[model samples]
Target: MNAKRKNKILTWIATISFGVISLIALFPIISLVISSLRPSSELMRQGISFSINFSQLSLDNYLYIFNQAPEYWAWYGNSLVISAITIVLSLFFSSMVGYALAVYDFKGKNFFFLLVLLILMVPFEILMLPLYQLMINTQLIDTYFAVVLPMVVAPVAVFFFRQYALGLPIQLMDAARIDGSTEYGIFFKIMLPLMGPSLAAMAILQGLGSWNNFLWPLLVLRSNDMFTLPIGLATLLTPYGNNYDVLIAGSVLTIIPIIILFVFFQRYFIAGLTTGGVKG
Candidate 1:
């Protein structure tokens, strides 16, 4: 084959491969949606199925979630608030920490960065007890602060930003300083814009993590009214009965914000993740 024909053939192969992969990944979402449309009787019989029985589907699940489930909306709003706060705080603090580590030559710089890496290496489960105790002592339990505080400075995010920042042009900081920019201005004005990919990548990841986070929030939030979506959803199942109709429908809706977030940041996501690792 000619060179042009060879390139076309390779492109077609890649397109077909990715298309198939996309369908496989999307299958769960499709199943969840279909399951939501099914009645509890139908769902309990076979569980979430891929097969369609148009006659068996109904709008009852959506109707119930919208009209009857006040607790569901409260849980959703709580999740939205918590996830939003967590994402904003995590990105702001983690980026600054990472930027400083990458750019500055402070006294214990290497040691601090080393400490971050060490902390990153340690699993959250190992540190959960101490963190929970810390929350309890601070009287932050049952408050949004309890969930948002511990995640504000994620070690992994710090590490990602630091690595990405290392690849940035330090000369720009010097130039800004020469032009009478303060250190904060130098970062916010010059360095931060350059770190766009890292920010976008982290925003999506942190948003997803916070949105799906069940364990820490479960531990901290005491009131039923204060519960996040994951925790609230779990309450739908009991030994005596299960509300698969509302649960499945609510679960499908839960993915909407995540889908919107990923779609918005997708262009930058791949670029950010790839570039962040390139430096360190």
Candidate 2:
């Protein structure tokens, strides 16, 4: 085939492939929203069908969820708190570490960067036992601090920020130093403003990770009051069967903040990913 003909064929194939994948990913979310809107009676009648009766749409499930399941609200609040704190702490610490790695000249700097990569290779499951034991010794179990303190520093965020920072011009830092700007001033006044995209991306990633975290929270938090959104939603399933409407509603609610964050910061989020990949 000619080059143009082959290119056309490849483009058509790629477009069709993407369309199929998009529909596959979209179907579940569409089904969840449809199910959440339908009344329980209609849902039962449908028997796994995606169809919903528009006339039977009601907010009772969501209202009942809030009124009956007070623990759900507690879990929601705990998740928000933990995610917010984790994002702030992670951004601060990661930026500092990444800046050091990107700018400073010192012995063992490459070794330290390798160590960050090494830590990322170690899965969280491997550290859980020792982490649990440490939490127990520190009497941190069943407390908010137990969840927030452990995740304040994230290797992935550090790696991302460092790569992004590497793309910055060293001339700017030298100029700032020549102008008598302190190291802290150069970071806060110069580097940080330039790092907005990467920071937004890191914040979104860290927030989602912290909010959806179940295993660590399950290990540390035993009380209903201490549960995060995922753990609380999991409790909605009983031995009999799951309440499909309520479960869907809870799941929808859990994803709202993430969707909102992406909607508002999507441009920066995309730029950050593209820049990081290029620099790396």
Candidate 3:
């Protein structure tokens, strides 16, 4: 075959392969959506499945969540608000620390960066007890602060930002300094805009992590009204009974914010990941 024809054939093969893979990845989500439309008893009988009983499927679960499930809405709001704040703060603090580590030289800078790397090596579960103690000592238990504080400057975000910043042009910062800009001005006005892809990428990641975070919030939050979506959904199942009607439906709704977040940031995600991965 000619080169052009060979390349076209390869492209078709790749496209077909990826299309199949995409469908496979979407199977669980599809099953969850289908489960949400069916009765809780049906789910208990067969669990989540592709078998569509056309006559039995109905909108009662969706209707119940929308009209009757006040707790679901509260949990939804809690997740959204906490995720938003965590994303903003994580991007802000982590990016600054990462940028400084990548670009600047100062006393103990190496030590600080080393500490961040060490943090990455340690699991959060190991630190949970101390963190929980700290929270209690600070009187932040049962508050949003307890959930938001731990992840505000996530080590992974800082590391990713640092890696991406290594690929940025340092001469730009030098020029800004020469033009009489302050350090903060150089970061906020110049460097930050250039780091758009990294910011967008981290926002989605951090937002997703914060939204799905269950253990930490479950540990700190005392009130039903303060529970996030994951914890709230967990409550739907108990030793006595399972509220699968609301569980499946509420779980389906939980996906909406994540889908919206990805849709908003997906354009920059690959670019951010590519540059971050390949750089120092």
Candidate 4:
């Protein structure tokens, strides 16, 4: 075959392969959606199966979630507020730390970076007890601050931002400084706009982590009103009875925010990942 024809054939094959992989990846989500539409009794009797009982499927679960579940909305709000704050604070603090590490010279910089790396290597499970104790000492339990504080300086975010920032030209900052711009001014006005892609990428990641975070919130948040989505959903299951109807429906609704988030940031996601991977 000619080179052009060979390349075209390969492209077709790659497209088909990717389409299949995409469908396979979407199977669980598809199943969840279908399960959510099914009656709870049906789910209990049949479990999850390919068999579609369209006749029995209805909007009862969704209605119950929307109309009857006040706690669900409270939990949803808590998750939203916590994740929003976490995203903003994480981006602010992590980016600043990462930016400084990328561009500035200071004492203990290497040591601090090394500490971040070491912390990243350690599992959160190992630190949970101590972190819980610290929270108790500070009396931050059952508060949103307890959930938001621990993750605000995410090590992974710092590392990624640092890698992306290292590739940014320092000449701009020098020029800005010469023009009477303070360090904060240069960063906020110049460097931040340039770091859009990395910022978007980290925002999505950090938002997702905070939204779905169950363990830390579970440990800290004692009241029902303070519970996040994951913990609130968990409360539906008990030794006596399980509220599968609301659980499945709530789970389906939980996906909507994340989908909106990805849609908003998707334009920059790939670009940010590529720059961070290549430069960092």
TM-score of 2: 0.85
**Candidate 2 residue runs with Cα over 4 Å from true position:** 1-21, 41-47, 242-245, 268-280
TM-score of 3: 0.86
Which one wins on TM-score?
4
TM-score (C-alpha, index-matched) for candidate 1:
0.86
Model 4 ranges with Cα > 4 A deviation: 1-21, 239-241, 267-280
Measured by lDDT, the strongest candidate is 4
Candidate 1 vs candidate 2, lDDT winner: 1
lDDT (CA) for every model shown? 0.87, 0.83, 0.86, 0.88
Candidate 1 local lDDT, 1-280, one digit each (tens): 6999999999999999999999999988888888888887778777766566889788899999999999999999999999899989999999999999999999999999999988877878887889999989989999999988878999888988998899999999899899999999999988999998789888877777798898899889999899999999888876433678778899989987667766887776565445435436
| Cα-based lDDT at residue 41, candidate 1 | 72
Lowest lDDT sum, 10 consecutive residues, model 1, at 270-279
The superposed Cα distance between candidate 3 and the true structure at residue 68, in angstroms, equals: 0.6
Query: After aligning candidate 1 to the native by TM-score, how far in Å is the CA of 102 from where it should be?
Result: 1.1
Count of residue pairs whose backbone atoms collide, per candidate: 0, 0, 0, 0
Kindly report the root-mean-square deviation of model 3 from the true structure over all alpha carbons: 3.3
Q: What is the lDDT of residue 104 in candidate 4?
A: 94
Write down the lDDT that model 4 would get. 0.88
Cα deviation in Å at residue 38, candidate 1? 1.0
**Tens digit of lDDT per residue, candidate 2, span 220-240?**
988989889888788876544
